[model samples]
Every structure is written in structure tokens, then in C-alpha cells.
Target: MINLAARDILHGWGKFLFTGIGLGLLIGTTLTMAGVFRGMVDDAQVLIDNSGADLWVVQQGTLGPYAEPSSIRDDVWRGIAGLPGVAETGNAAYLTIQMAHAGRESRVMIVGMDVDRPGRPGAPGYLTAGRPILHGHYEAIADERTGLQLGERVRLRRHEYTVVGLTRRMVSSSGDPMIFVSLKDAQEIQFLKDNDALVNERARTAANPAFNRPGVPGLLEAAQASSGQSRNVNAVLVRLEPGANPDAVAGEIQRWKRLTAYTREQMEDILVAKLIATSAKQIGMFLIILAVVTAAIIAFIIYTMTMAKLREIAVLKLIGAQNRTIAMMILQQALSLGLLGFLVGRASAGLWGPAFPKYVLLLPGDAIGGFMVVMVISALASVVAIRAALAIDPAEAIGG
Candidate 1:
């Protein structure tokens, strides 16, 4: 018996190949969408893991630094430091801002970390080039993705910082490159005001009767000085003693210190479930829609291919070709198309994943999962065309 599937593909290979390529591009996009979600989750986990913190202490009842704006006094870590099971504590300030570098503006997460220790909670896990920040003021460490070279100066607010170190995979949950600066500088940048604004504020305060009373000699100057300084940090990163439970330590901080404490698990939940939840759901919806579209396209192609072989199909039926044979022919064609599409998709996603601005982590397991999904969808979609072909009677072959 002739190989009907092979014959059909060979006879109309152009249409079949082009249709497969189109479907492949769609499938590629679908796979990329899934990869985008995976990349987001990976980035969140990496952000948490790289922090090397057992717990995060934020302002009371608020998600800090990532999900929302959280400000706690820089000294709050002192209280948390004295808590039991706390191995070490660090004050980390995270502020997302647009900074100008080489005449282009890029949004970066400015992470303020203590430079005295190399293994501090918020320090970079590893460096791609150069070393960690050693000096306190005017020095910076940037992720490689920022495209800033060592010794490059980037201006943040009114201050400029020299890029002293470089790191890899150091990113915010949104995949923005993280730039490390000293806590003091971060605080200043966070609250830095323009000279005109400062002058106007001083004038306004000096005019206030309560602050400008004759008995208050230096009250106005003192007030202005205090206003010029920032003593706040976004969140405190805490490391628990080995063998100590993070949840328990977090509870002590919350109860005694009157601050919100989150364990590693809790922080992950907040980042994934709350921070990027809507985006994940949106991608999921797009994946579903794309899958449906891919299936429809495959079904249409297979149906059209089968229809072109109407005379052959009718003759095969007339010559005692079993219904199973016809069905298998359609099924195999569908599967082949799906296989072709998947190959093209995987290649396309691989080629384009790195070009994306955000992290597009394409894992082997995810690729395997995508392949299975494509096969299943192709099989299901073939049902429509299979039914249509099976319904055609062999008598149609002999019709006028």
C-alpha cells in the first residue's frame, strides 16, 4: 500500500511547509509567553536568594521595597539585630528611579547596601567583573545588563557615582538592573532636593512664627539642616542563626519591635503572588488564546490538505480502504505539522529569548512541557477535520 501521508505531503509540500511555518511562529510566541512568566518567577526567586536574608523587616503591615513603598527608620535594624536567633542584620534601601548615563536614561533599582562586609545580606551574590563597593560615598556597583563599564560615572539626582563594580543577574522583580550604592548616598538621593526647592522651603520655614520666634536663636537653621537629611531605609534584611527558624525569628521582631516581618517563604509569596500576580495571569490568558489560535490554524491546514486529496480519498474508500486508515492519515499529518511547528518554535524562542529586555529564562523542562502541549493540541484540533473527511462517502468519487 502507498504511503498516503507521505504522498500528500510531497505533492503539496509548499503549502504544508508554509502553513507549518506560520503555525510555528504562533507557537513560538506562545512558548515565549510561557517563558516570560517563568523568567519573572525566576527573577523574583533570584532576587530573594541573592539577598541572603532569612527574613525581611518592613514598615508595619506593608510589603516593602518591592510591592509598595516602605519606609522605616534606618536605625530600626538595631532593634531587630538584638533579637534572638538573629545572626546579622543589614539596612537595605531600594529606590527605583530613572538615571542618566551617557546621554540615555535607564530605569534602575538603586540598592543601598553596607560596604564594610562582603557577605552582607543585600550584597551581590557574585560579581561578573570588578569588586564590590569598598568606599562609602560616590561609588557604585551595577549589573552587567546596565551596560555601564567600570569607572563610568552615572548621575543619580544631584550626585554622581563612579561605577566601581559589576554583577550578573542582579535585577529587581521587574527585571530592571540593580545599581548598588552606599546607604548614606541612597538616603540622600532618595530625599535630595533641588537648590531652588531647598531655598524656597527654608524661606517658608523661616517665615513660620512658631519656628522664627526671637527666643529660638538657631531653630530655623537646625530645622532646615534636619530637613535636608534623610534617615530612612526601605527595608531591613535579617539573617537567622544556623538551625534557627525564620518564622519564629520574624515573629519576635513583629511582636517586640512592632514592625512587619516576613520569612523567606512569605516574602516569596508576596513577590510572586502579589507583586507579579496580575502579569502572570495576563500572560496565562494570552497563552490560552494563542494555543487556541494555533490549534485552529493547524486544523484548517490539515482540512484543506485533506480536501485537496478528495479524489484519492474517495478512491481509497472505494477500493476498500478502512475508515481507520483514513483517520490515521489525518492524525499523522496533524502530528507531523505539530512536530514541525514545535521545532521551529523552540528554535525561534531560543534565538530571540536573549534579545528581550526582561529576563527570558527558557528551561529545558518548560520546553519539554511546551512540546507535549503542542502535540495534545494538534491531536485535539485534528478531530474537526477528521470528522469531516470520514463523513464523505465513497460515492462522491463517481459523481458527475
Candidate 2:
């Protein structure tokens, strides 16, 4: 028996090739969406890994430093350092802002860390180009993604910080590049407002009845003075001793300090599951929509191709061809298109994944799963064509 599907495809090779190319582009977009979601999860993991801390201490009843707004006394780390099984502790604050350097602007996460200690939490894990922050007040270690160079000054929140070091792949949970600065400066930049906002707040405080009363002497002046300084840290990072129990130390801090303590696992859950919930949902929806659209396109192509071969199909039936043979012919063509499309889509995703502004991690498993789904979709889409072909009357070939 001759291969009917192969013969038909060769007769219309151009049409089949062009149709598969269109489907391939659609499949490529779907693959890219999966890569984007994978990248987000990896970004969260990277954030946890780079901190180099076993436990995160934050404000009571709140998620901190990434998922939610948390405030704790800047000096709380001193007490935490004395806890049993605690090897090292560092205070950190985070603030995201759009910063300009040499007429170019990029959004970045400004990390305030303890520059007094080497290998401190929140410090960059590796330096790609320059050294770490040396001076306390205005020195910075910027991620290479931020487009900042060594010896460049980036004016941020009333202070100009000189970039002295460069790090690679140091990004926040939101995929913004991080710029490391001294704890004091980060506190001020994170908590302090602009000059005008400060003036307004001070004026409001001075006009309050409790502060501006005639019986109160210098109360308003003192309140105004206190408002200008930043003494709050968002979170404290703790490193454990070689044989220490993180849960026990965290419990001690919670019981005595009245602050929240989260182990590394808990922090990862917050960042990946809670913080990125909405974004994940959005990507899921896009994937679903793309799947539906791709299925529709495939169905249309297969149905049209089968309908166009009605005369040939009628002649085959009149010559005593079995229904299985005609059905197999259509199914084979559909699978061929799917296979070609998948190869093109996989190649496209690999070539363009790195060009994305944020990370796009295309894992091997995802690619394999995607190919399986595409093939299944192709088989299912061929159902309409198969059924239509089987319905052709053998008499039609002789009647004309």
C-alpha cells in the first residue's frame, strides 16, 4: 500500500510548511511564558541564597524586607547577636527607586547593609568588576544590571553615592538590580522623605495640640528634631552556629524580643508563594489563552486541508479504500505539522530567552512537557478533519 499522507504532503509542501511555521510562532510564545514564570521563582530563590542568613527577623505580625512593609528598631540586632547558637547578625533595609546615572534612568533596589563587617548579610555574594563598599556614608556596590560604572556618582534621596563595586545577578524579589550602601544611609533613604515632605510633616506636628500647647516647653521643637533621623531597620539577618537549631533561636527571639522570626524555608514560601501569587496567576491565564488560540489555529488548518482533498478521498472510497486508511492519512499530516512546529518553537525560545530584561529560565523539563502537550493538541485537533473525511460518499466520485 502506498503512503497516502506522505504523497499528499509532498504535493502541497509549501502550504504545509508555511502553516507549520505560523503554528510554531504561537508555540514559541507559550514556551516563553513558562520560562518567565520559572525565572521569577529562581529570582526569589536567588534572593534568599545571596543573603547568606539562616533566619530573618522582622516586625511582629508582618512579612518583611520583600513581601510586606516591616519596621523594627535598628539596634535590635545587638540583642539578637547574643542569643544562643547565633554566630552573626546584621541589620538590613530595602527601598526601591528609579535612579538616574549619566542621563540614563533605571529602577533598582537600594540595600542598606552593615558595611562594618565583611560577608555581612545583604551584601553582594560576588564582585564582578569592582570592590565592596568601603566608606560608610556615600559608597555603593551596584549590580551590573543597573548600568552604573565604577567611580560614578548616583544621586539618590538627597545624597550622591559613589559606585565603588560591581556585582552580578544581585537582584531583589521583584527582579530589580540591587545597589548596596551603608546601613545608616539606607535607613535614611528608606525612611526619610524629600525636603518638602519633611517640612510638611514637621509643620503638621508643630500644629498639634499636644505638642504646641502653652504648657509644653520645647516639646514641638524636640518632635521636629526627631522626625529628621532614620533609626528603623526593615529586617535583621541571623547566621547560626555549626550545630545550632534555628527554630530554637527563633523561638528565643520571639519570646523575649516580641519580634517575628522566620527560618530560610519560611522566607522562601513568602517570597515565592505569597509575594508572587498575582503575577503567577497572570502568567497562567496567558498560557491558557495561548493554548486555546493555538488549538483553534491547528483545527482550522487540519479541517481545511482535509476538506480540500474531498475529490481524492471520494475516489479512494469508491475504489474500496477502508475508512481507517483515510483517517490515518489525516492524523499523520496533523502530527507532522505538530512535530515541525515544536522544533521551531524550541529553537526560538532558546535564542531569545536571554535577551529578556528580566531572567527567563527555560528548563529541560518544561520543554519536554510543552512538546508533549503540543502533540496531544495536534492529535485532538485532527478529530474534526478525520470525521469529515470519513463522511464522504463513494457515489460522489462517479456521479460527477
Candidate 3:
């Protein structure tokens, strides 16, 4: 017996091909959404990996450095360094702000790290160009995604920083490109008040009798000077000794230091689960909507195709064609359309994924899963058309 599905598709190849292409574009968008979600998870993992720390020490009772506002004295790392199983510790400050370039401003995550220790925790893992921050204040190591070239000057708050190095794929949990600066500069930028605010603050301090008692000479000047500096950091990054248990070290730090300590796994969970949770849910909703739309479109196409071939279906029935055979024909056509659409969508996603502003990681596993879902949706969508065809009266072949 002739293959009815193949014959019908070949007979109306143009319509079938175009319909598949349209459906494929929709599928492509769904696939791209999955990739975007995957990219976010990857970006979060990259952040944890690049920090080079086994644990993060933040302010007590708070998720710090990324998820929430956490401020502790910059000197906190000194005590954390002496903890057992701690091999190295670094003071890190994170401030997401707009940095001015030549004519426009770009939002970037300004990472303050211990510049004195090159290749330490919180420093850029690798440089694609130039060297790390050598000078104490103005030098920076920028992520390539920030559009900052090596030696380019970018202003951060009150100071101009020269991008001394460029690193690739160095981004924060929110996918913001990171610009690494000295810990002192980061602290100042993160916490220091503006010049006007500072002046007003000093005047308030001088006017307050409690702080500036006339009997205590030099007290007012000392208070004003101390108010101008920022000595706070967001978190302390701790590297553990080889083979040390991260949980054990984190527990010790939390118990002894009176601070919150997050192990690598805990930090990853916070970043993926809490930090980007809303975004992930939004993407998931989009995926669900897209799946519903795709199914509806497939069902409509199949139903229309079946209705148009009603007379043919009637004639087949009049010629003693079995209902199961007709059902198989429709099922095969739906599967073929779905297969075509999936191939087009997979290719489309790969082509345009890199052009997105943020990373889009298209994993092979996701593609496989998407393809399976599409085929299943296609089969289910054919039910309406199959039912319609099975209801046809054989007498209609001769009457019409």
C-alpha cells in the first residue's frame, strides 16, 4: 500500500513546509528560553567557581556580597584567616553601580579585592589582555563583556580607573560584568558619602555637643576626619587547606567568629535558588505558555488539513480503507511536521543564541528533551483531526 501521509505531504509540500517553518520559529523561541535559564544557572556557577573560595564569611544573619546588603568591617578577614582549616582569606566588597565611559554609562559590578595579593580569592581568575591591578587605587581588571578595553579610563564615583586587564566570562550572579578594583577603593565607593553629604555630616558632628565637647580639644577635628573614611567590606572570601571539609570549616567560622558562613554549595544554592529565582520562574512560565501555544497551533494545522481532505478521506473509506490506517496516516503527518519544526528550531536557537546580551548556553541535553516534547505534542495534537476524519460518511465521496 502507498504511504498516504508521505503522498499527502509531497502533494502540498509548500504549505506543509511553510507551516512547519512557522511552528519551528515558535519552538526555537521556547528552546532559546531554556538556554537563557541554563545560562543563568551557569553564570551563577561561574561566579562561585571564579571566587576561588571554599567558603564565604558574611555579616551575621544575612546573605551577603550578592543576594543582600551585607557590610562588615574590612578588618574582619584578619580574624577569619587565623581559623583552623583556613589557608587564605581575602576582603571582598561588591557594589553594583553605573560607571561612566567616554560618552555613555554602563552598569557594572565593582569588585573590591585585596590587590596586594595577586591571584588571590576574589581576583579575576584569568586575563585575556594586559595585567592585573598593580597600583593601589585607580587600576582595574574589567570583564570583556563590559565593553572596556585595556588602558581605557572609566570613572567610578569620585575616581577615574584605568582598565589594566580584560577578563572573559567574569560576571556577577545577575549577569553584570565585573570591574575589579582595590579593596580600599571599592569600600570607599560602596560606603563613602558624597562631598556635600560629607560636609553636612561634619557640620552636624561639630554642632553636636555630645561629640564635640569644648573641654576636649581636637575631638571635633578627629571626629570629622574619621567620618570621611569607609572601612567596611561586603564579605570575606576564605580558601581552605587541601582536603579540608568545607562544611566543617564553615561551621567553625560561624560558631567562633559570630558571623554567617556559607560553604561553596550553600553559596551556589543562594545564587541559583534565591538570587535568580524570580527570573527562573518567569522563564518557566514563558516555556509553559509557549508549549501551549505550540500545541494549539499544531492542532489547528492538522485539523484544517484534515477538513480540507474530507472528500479524499470519504473516498478512502468508500474504498474499504480501515479507520486505523487513516489514523496512522494523520499521526505520521503530524510527527513529520513536528520533526521538521524541531530541526529548524534547534538550528535557529544555535544561530541566534550568542547574539543575546547575556550568555545563552544551549546544552545538547536540552535540545534532546525539547525534541522529544515537540514530537509528543505533535502526536497529541493530531487527535482532533483524526477524530474528525474517522467521523466522515463514505456516502459523501459519491454525493459530493
lDDT of 2 by residue, 32-109 (tens): 999999999999999999999999999999989799899999999999999999999999999999898768788899
Tell me each candidate's TM-score: 0.97, 0.93, 0.96
RMSD of each: 1.2, 2.2, 1.5
Q: Give the C-alpha lDDT of model 2.
A: 0.91
Put the candidates in lDDT order, highest first: 3, 2, 1
lDDT of 3 at 260: 95
Question: Clashes per prediction?
Answer: 0, 0, 0
Better of 2 and 3 by lDDT: 3
lDDT of 3 at 179: 92
- The list of candidate 3 runs beyond 4 A from truth reads none
How far off is residue 311 in model 3, in Å? Answer: 0.6
Q: Rank the candidates by TM-score, best first.
A: 1, 3, 2
Q: What is the lDDT of residue 77 in candidate 1?
A: 84
**Residue-level lDDT for 78 in candidate 3:** 88
For residue 105, give model 3's deviation from the true position in Å. Answer: 3.5
Indicate the residue-level lDDT of 26 in model 1: 90
